[model samples]
Target: MAERKSALKRAPARPELNEKLEKAKKQVITEEQLQEQRASFVYGNAPKGSRITKESAIKATKHIRVVTPAAA
Candidate 1:
């Protein structure tokens, strides 16, 4: 015959863990933070003392000139 299983017990909580949880719960994100995260995800890492934002966007030239050899 098999024996019955007992209920699992919980470990005592630490004050440091509680503090960290409280800090995380109270943390808030700002618009700039969202922008930085988005930039990092799309463009990889940033440089020291400076970060790339959406303001510096790259655009392709719309005008192109094509010339054919002088009536060869």
Candidate 2:
């Protein structure tokens, strides 16, 4: 007796895969352009506390600095 091939077995079509690959290739953009676009969104919208006064900056740095002990 000869073995028979299954009729349900099939291979994927090439055109669908090619179309997906072409779409993926066109979606890429550079990081520099992305950053430039993001910068435009916040061009004039500064946060309330974003303005750093000299006194406040000095105080913040003083509080955040770590002191080291002398080695014997």
Candidate 3:
């Protein structure tokens, strides 16, 4: 029986991509920017007293059969 060996090849390193990655690593987020982002997520532009309640959810889904995995 004869034996053979296989070799793997790799791509050359990119200095431009390394420089971009280093720039991205040095990027920082300020506290004000973080607070603004969190506020935008937590508080929407909806009018007051327009939130959905449990009664509203029940009423909306009264005629629908929302089947669960457990029921199936």
Best by TM-score: 1
Q: Model 2, 20-71: lDDT tens per residue?
A: 9999899977755555444544443435667755444444443444569899
Show model 1 residue runs off by greater than 4 Å: 1-12, 44-72
Q: Which 10-residue span in candidate 2 carries the lowest summed lDDT?
A: 56-65
**Model 3 stretches astray by more than 4 angstroms:** 1-8, 31-72
TM-score of 1: 0.34
lDDT of each: 0.57, 0.61, 0.61
Instruction: Please give, for residues 12-47, the per-residue lDDT of candidate 3 as tens digits.
Output: 799999999999899898856655554454345435
For model 1, residues 1-72, the per-residue Cα lDDT tens digits are 999776676768799999999999998988567556655554444454565544441111112235787975
What order do you get sorting by TM-score, best first?
A: 1, 3, 2
Count clashing residue pairs in model 3. 0
Task: Provide TM-scores for the models.
Answer: 0.34, 0.25, 0.29
TM-score of 3: 0.29
What is residue 31's positional error in candidate 1, in angstroms? 0.6
Worst 10 residues of 1 by lDDT: 56-65
Cα lDDT over the full model 2: 0.61
Candidate 3 or 1, higher TM-score: 1
Look at candidate 1 and give me any clashing residue pairs: none
